[model samples]
Structures are given as C-alpha cells and as structure tokens.
Target: MLAPVTDETLMRRIEQFIHAEARLQDEHAYEAWEQLWTDDAIYWVPANGADIDPKSQMSIIYDNRSRIGIRVKQLLTGKRYTQEPKSNIRHFVTNIEVTGREGDDISVGCNVMVYESSLRGETIWAARTDYTLRDEAGAFRMARKKVALVNNDRPLYTLSFLI
Candidate 1:
C-alpha cells in the first residue's frame, strides 16, 4: 500500500503546483503549462452555480489538450487580434484546503483572485478552484482543474489569457 501524505507535505506540494502554474502562464511558457496536465486532463471554468458536468451546463471555458493548444497558438501568434496588445495577468491563489485524497490522486480547493492590467485598465476577478492532481512517476500532474468564477453568470468582457 502507498504511504499517506502528511498535511505539511500535501500543502507544500499543492502550493508549489499552484505557484508553478501561475509562473508558467505569466512567462508565456505554454509548453511547460501543457506538460503540467495528464493525458486526459480537463480544464474547466464554469459559470456561477453551474453543475460540474460540462456536457449539461455552459462553461465559460472548457479545454482539453487540443483546445489548450489552440489557445496557446492564439496567444502566441501575432495574427490573432487579441495578441496585438497582450493583457498582463497576475493570479493570486490562497486559502488552500485539502478536501480529500486517494492513492495517487489528491483533491484540493482554493480561492483565487486574478488581476488584469492593460492599457484599458485593471479588473479584479475572483473564483474558487478545485484541482484533482494525480501522481505520475512520482510527479503530480493535474487531472482536472475546475474554476468557478464569482461573476460567471454576469456578462463578461474578452478574456485573452488562461485563468
């Protein structure tokens, strides 16, 4: 049987994972970001109060590797209109709580506040994120990332980057 993860170890690993992801995105390291996920990983930004089932409810963003690839392409390619003047985003993740864990997988929950600054202005957005991380060859890879934004139900503006 596998050994259980201590609270300290789990928290440290979770924070490290979150910070690494933030840094990767901020640096526009799409290849590194892609490697953070499992083969069948799912990235979801759900509408407020919406169900987790992607098929049933509309998600603000839902992506697998292919969709993630397209998004990366759009962001990197100068031909994409949104890339004309890229928006700068900083993600602040905190209040991390571990909900559960199974052999090679862990369930983590946290609060996120994202700040975006551009020539247009600055906007602050908040969300609650749940992550399912699985161990692969002793490294953690995200199996699922669910982000439920507080203002998801309201009308939104353009989102040029991953949240």
Candidate 2:
C-alpha cells in the first residue's frame, strides 16, 4: 500500500499539475495535454456548480478522452471556423487548494484567468477548475476535470480548444 501525501505535498502537486496543463495549452501541445489523463478520464465544464451532473444539465463542455482527441484534432487542423486566424491564449491559475483526498485520488480547486487575443483584440475570462487526480504508476493522471465559469449561463463564443 502507498503512503498518503502530506497536505503541503498534495497542494504543491496540484499546483504543478495545473501549471503544466496551462503551459501545454498555451504552447498548443494538445497531444501532450491529452497524455495527462487516464484512458477513462472525463473533462467536464459544468454550467452551474461542480456538484451538478453534466448528463442532466447542459455543460459548457463534457468530453471523454476520445472527444478530447477530436477537439484537439480540430484545433490543429485549422479547419475549425472559430479557430480561423487562431487565438493566442494565456491562462493564469491561482488560489490552488486541495479540498479532500481519498486513497490515490485527490480533489483540488483553483481559479483561472484566461486572456485570449484574436483579430478583435484581447478578452479576459475567469473560471474555477475543480480537478480529481489519481496517482498512477507514481505519476498523477486526471480522473475528472470540472471547469465552472463565473458566467456559465451567459452566451459563449465558440471554444476551439480545451479550457
């Protein structure tokens, strides 16, 4: 059996994971980002609270590994209408807190500020990302990723990449 991680270690790991994910997305390394999840992983962007079931409520995005791959492919292909001319984005993650842990799985919550620039210039958006991670083979793989936007109910522009 594996020993549990200390609170400090767990927090640090969560922060590192968030930063790595942001970097991968900023660099447009979709394949690398996809590798961060397990085979059965789910990425969810809940419209309301994290507790809400995506199946019941409309989600900003609720994708499995295969769906994620398709999204990545669309982004990279330059065929996605929303991605035409492309948008440069930088994500700032902060307030990382580990809320709970059970066995190899840890629950983390953090705030994200994403700045995206296109022909229309820059737009700033904020959201909260709740992550569930599992320690597998001594590395962390995402089990569930839930993004709760402050303006989830508001109309959204087309999303070409993973948030």
Candidate 3:
C-alpha cells in the first residue's frame, strides 16, 4: 500500500508549484504558463473592486481556456504595440497560504507585487490573487485564477503582461 501525503508535504508541493508558475510569467514563457493550467481553466482580473462579480461587473480580464490560448497567441505574434518591447517584469509572490481543499481541488491565496520597466517608465503594481489548483495524480494545474488589483478603482496603466 502507498503512504498518504502529510499536510506539510502537500503545502510544500503547492508552494513549489506556485513559485514555478511565477517564474514562467517572469520569463515571459506564455506557452509554458498556459500549460500550467487545466483545460477548463478560468483567468480573471476584476475591475474597480475585488468583490465585483465578473459576470455582472466590468473586468480587466476574464478569459476561459480558449481565450487564454488566444491571448497567448496575440502576445506571441510580435504585433501587440504595448508588448513590442515586452516590458521587463519580475513579480514577487508573498503570503502564500492554502485556504481550503475539497477532493482534488485546493484553494490558495497570495499577494503579488510586479515591477515592470519599459520604455515609458517603471511601474509597480500590487494585487491579491486567489487560485484554485486541481491535483491530478500528484500533478497540479490551475483551475481558476482571480487577481484583484490594489488600485483597481483608479485609472491604471495598460496591463499587457500576465499577472
């Protein structure tokens, strides 16, 4: 019989997975980042407020798996003006915690601060991100990713990179 994993082991695995995902984004490896998601993934960034319903309220981004693919394609095309130079970005993920778990799904929350520098200028963006990861046979894939920008209620610069 196989031994069951302990909570400490599982949390370590989850943290490592999350850190790898962040590195993929920082490297602008969109294709690899997409692979980190499950087939039925949902990526969302609420506009104006963190608690707003994406279906009823405006959203900075609300993409399903297909839409995420399209977005990746757009970024890879070398045609997006905002991404022409591809802002140099490196985000720090902090306060990572496993909030809940049900069956194969695990919920995680963290705070992120992304520092992006482009021709225009350098900008730092802060946000709280919630993620639901589906554990499939010991592998983890993102099922849902929701980002709530700290200054979402105010005017913001163009967000052309993954958060």
What is the number of backbone collisions in each predicted candidate, taken in the order shown?
0, 0, 0
Residue 140 lDDT (model 3):
96
Q: Best lDDT goes to which candidate?
A: 3
lDDT string, candidate 3, 49-140, tens digits: 99998999899999999999999999999887988789999989998888878899998988999999988899999999999999988899
Q: Which residue pairs clash in candidate 2?
A: none
| Model 1: per-residue Cα lDDT at residue 49 | 68
Q: Largest TM-score belongs to which candidate?
A: 3
Tens digits of per-residue lDDT for model 1, 4-23: 44768767877898889888
Q: After superposing candidate 2, which stretches have Cα over 4 Å from the reference?
A: 1-7, 48-51
Query: Higher TM-score: candidate 1 or 3?
Result: 3
Backbone clash total, candidate 1: 0
lDDT of 2: 0.82
State residue 63's C-alpha deviation in candidate 3, in Å. 0.5
- The models' CA-based lDDT, in order, is 0.80, 0.82, 0.91
